[model samples]
Target: MSNGKPVYKLIDGKGRVLIPKELRSAAGMDYGDIVRLGVTNGRVSIRKIDIIEVGDQSPDAVKAYVRAAFKTMPDDTRLSLIAELTELLKQKKEV
Candidate 1:
């Protein structure tokens, strides 16, 4: 199965909300990365770290990442993956 989603537990006496190790690795978080807390639709969401959008990344890096992301898809998903990546690339370029 894919890595389970992050779940926050109560803060400890030291005022730290312990995050599960699996979640941490899945999100690629290292110590000292700033995390964001938010509430939407009455559900609390915690981002392990602030993500830099495509504008903050190199064009070649973005293309490579996109290629890698869609490389493993089964044949049935290749067309859909291409379409989605095209739209995503368009949106990122606009940002």
Candidate 2:
């Protein structure tokens, strides 16, 4: 899957494209996993979304967890997350 060769896939009539098993395995994707899709400049990207549960945690504990997790995220992902959070905050402010 990492051979630097492109794999072609056909889009079904319903506009669904099936990801091959090898590529999915390489990307750490599996059945039932949540994924984020981004389209830019005629290119489409897919990334698996990681979910974290912080139920009932203290504010400081949650902050600590987020800080640690943020440190390990890729720069692009961190920026995207920040942009999303900013948009949410703006919407909340408007409300």
Alpha-carbon RMSD, each predicted model: 13.0, 14.0
lDDT of 1 at 39: 100
Across 1-95, the per-residue lDDT of candidate 2 in tens digits comes to 58979999899999999999999999988765656677999999988765534373767446646765787789999999999999999999999
- Per-candidate TM-score against the hidden true structure: 0.38, 0.51
Candidate 2: where is the Cα deviation over 4 Å? 52-95
Per-residue lDDT of 1-95 in model 1, one digit per residue for the tens?
Answer: 14455454798899777776677777776565545567999986777534434464667445545555555568779988778989999999999
Per-model CA lDDT versus the true structure: 0.65, 0.79
Global Cα lDDT for candidate 1: 0.65
Q: Worst ten-residue run, lDDT, model 2? A: 52-61
